[model samples]
Target: MTTTISYEQAKAYYEQWGVNVDLALKQLNQIPISIHCWQGDDISGFETIKSELSGGIDVTGNYPGKARNGDELRSDLEKALSLIPGKHRVNLHAIYAETNGQFVDRDEILPEHFAKWVDWAKQNGLGLDFNPTLFSHEKANDGLTLSHPDEHIRQFWIDHCIASRKIGEYFGKELGTPCLTNIWIPDGYKDIPSDRLTPRVRLKESLDTIFEYKTDEKYNIDAVESKLFGLGSESYVVGSHEFYLSYAQQNNKLCLLDTGHFHPTETISNKISTMLLFNEKVALHVSRPVRWDSDHVVILDDELKEIALEIVRNNAIERVLIGLDFFDASINRIAAWIIGTRNMIKALLYALLIPHNYLKELQEQGNFTERLALIEEFKTYPFGAIWDHYCEISNVPIREKWLQEVQIYEKDILSKR
Candidate 1:
């Protein structure tokens, strides 16, 4: 049922086929994009950038919660929300305790803080990115050790899932928006090539529990956030196409693809095809890829970028949830967020310029050679323009304004740097 096409054929079709620029522009504007949050003390810079790009933020991983009570968290959420327009949405991460490469029990999580976060999320219109770290130490530490797979950890994961289910139920009863659970299994292989079969079985067991817990939910409940690993030269799990697709098919779960997670060996089009074969149950965490590092950089149009964008355009699946998974180690946290948001918006605009019908034909045929050829043709078209034309058309003015303000801020920060 999979189609194949050549790169050249894809290019010829794109060159010959006319694209509806206006329609593409409108669709691009409507796409929901978010920024990943690691630091959350002050989101002012993110807010400013959101205002400019007209996108939302996805608060993931660890975030600061120095606030004293639910009201304080709520107040912080409101301030963050106010930065973006009503059309944009925000998702918050469930806080977990980690120590020395292991997940501390739920009892270890500060009760008052936990309750505050739950209540704050309910009071505000934010969604939750429920993590499954209680089940494994990968997110907390780094690698997946198969020989010493934590069986004791399974119970903790079950407890966390049940607790999250309760939170979701509470949200449904109180706020009418279903609490969302996102599972990103950081569990994978390290050195010595551990028993892959055992971890795979455990991964299934954990997912089954999660599915059972949320099966009766009336609203959106769970998304399997699939990741490919990159930590120096270390090997990680869920890094291959076969592994990801097989997991999704086996669990009957929607697949969430992180753009930067894939190794250099994988192809984006192949990933998209897998998602499409599974009824378009795919949500994307879109970011740029850097070799040997999941830098989560801003995506822009180059040859490879065009191919990636083409896959999405041709697929045309509406369930896609776009978010940026980025990190800001330098400068004030706010500025990092702003820069990240601006870059994402620019990437979206670039994607909009792709010739959809041409891509669709190539995808339908599943021809890699034709696909590469078309990509080359696309490269040479109009002086080898990829995303630049769309960027010029859509983001130039906003970027100019951002530059004017950011330059001054950059100078001040650089003086400190």
Candidate 2:
């Protein structure tokens, strides 16, 4: 059937359930997903003095045509953005600073170092987010940065985070969108620690120092990311979830919940509503975890849909900050971004198309049988048709047609790289 016919048929089915298909499409268009720049280069930022990949973060598969420099990364990102529907933001790390081949350490990075990124963001009409690189450095070789025992090393990381917030502020000021400056440190112990309290104490102190050097909240919003465990830090992660959640509440900062940072059974979908209740705004690093905290490409799985449903049903779409955070070097990097981001948007669209109010009424009225039946029946609904129409209207390729574009780019651009 033609796309228009399928979409028309699908609209009638949704309207029967009191779903406003057009409103859903309009709302989905306005939600911006912050795409991570590290995906383009396997988190290998454009730092002159490169360090080994540490902090339990690992990107496997040396896929050919991975971005080699800042210009190449931006070029690749532009291509990905072209394929993705709706306006989006790009998240950057402190190590992506362009310093003319000068060995500027993390602590020394300044907003001026990222002036080019700001200019590029302006040109692309994209907002920018920031992260302070806390791993893969001499200071964090022990897998302890902000919580390092050495006061000097701790101070260095603190300075870097402070500097990163300023850069985030610069991005917001230049692009007219507040930057989400998040700090994710791979600080933990490889095995059972005789002392966990001391390290967390130091971490808390370091964060206090960093947050003390505040930037305007109107321009830059600070966030603290917690991890469960990493490659080396299997037993203890200094920045535990409880730690950051409480810290965010007390300090009025944002808590960044990485989907992969929690245990396998723990889902971020369940935590969203709880976080929403306490914090004015919560941040998310949406990712898929296979067995462990592996940064796998996101798929439109049950959890992803439930996450979108929670955000939409609770009317917390604007309050929750959503960002993509997965890096897979095995397949085409651009394809990875396209697939992950498209799935995220698709999940949001799916949630928007659902008759959430009716479902809630069913639950509230204890109509469990009907609720289950309706929910299951909607799974077979013409969601794909609505999605295709959305892509058609948004001027992006519908369905697997986008794969051809990726293949063409791979052959024409990526193969040559």
Candidate 3:
């Protein structure tokens, strides 16, 4: 079978279904996805005296050309940002600091460490977000950080987090957009622990101290991320989803939901509405988890679609933030970034094209059969044509053409690395 639809034809078809193609494109253009910087370097950022990646974090393949340092990582990121549509933001971990052989520890980090990144983002018209690097440090070897049993260890992490917040605020002020500072500590016990409450209590106290100094909300926002479990922390994790969700609500902070930090059968779509309802705004770390929380490259899959649908249906685009959090070193790093990011945008656009009001009316009036039919019928719509048009207007390659660019990049650039 061979078929093709012209722009006029596709636009007319979408209009018939009460979907305004123009509106969809405009909405998608306004939404900026925060691409994780660690992907360029296989989660190995530019920190001196690096520690083993503890917690549930590990990158499998030793793909030939991984970014060894800051320069290579930035160069590859430039290639990636060029291909993706919309004005995007870059998410940076604390480990990616561009120190000029200063050799500062995490607890001693300051806004000066990321001065170049802030300048670069300003020149490129990009927003920036930050995370405190709580794993892969000598102190984190025991699979504990802020929630560590020792007070000195916990306070060290607390000071680091406090420094991270100041740095995030600096990025926000210098770039003229709010910088989201997220705290995700890999503190948990690999085996069954007799005392869980004490650790959590200590964690709460440590967080309280970190948040004691606040930056202007207009410039910076604070968030806490929770994980179900990780590599070493298999038996117990201190910061679970329930803990962070509750803490965020009570303390007036944003709750960051990582898609990979959930049970196999649990879909983040189910939690979106609740987060939107309770918090003033919510942040999301969208990634594909195959079987368990094995951070795989994202695709236009079922859970991703449902997640996009929930946001669009609730009209929570402005109230929610979308960020990518996955690293696959098994393939071309830049391609992995583009594929996952474009799919994130693609899923959102798909959700925007859905006629939600009409469908909701159908379900409310006892027309289950009609509603189900409409749902299935929507799957066959001219979504690809609309998507291609978006790519065209955004000046990016459409269909399979983008992959060819990646291949060329590999031959000329990534292959050399």
lDDT per model, in order?
A: 0.47, 0.92, 0.88
Using TM-score as the yardstick, the better of models 1 and 2 is 2
C-alpha RMSD values across all candidates:
10.2, 1.0, 1.8
Each prediction's TM-score versus the true structure: 0.64, 0.98, 0.97
> For model 1, how does the per-residue alpha-carbon lDDT over 71-167 read when each residue is reduced to its tens digit?
4434433443333322233444434222333444442432332454456556654544433332223323434321125765555555655655554
**Model 2: residues with Cα > 4 Å off, grouped in runs:** none
Per lDDT, the best of the predicted structures is 2
Model 1: per-residue Cα lDDT at residue 381: 51
Write the residue-wise lDDT of candidate 2 on 157-262 in tens digits: 9989988888999888999999999999999988999998999999999999998887998899999998898799999999999999888899999999999999
Q: How does residue 124 of candidate 3 score in lDDT?
A: 86
Task: Report model 2's TM-score to 2 decimal places.
Answer: 0.98
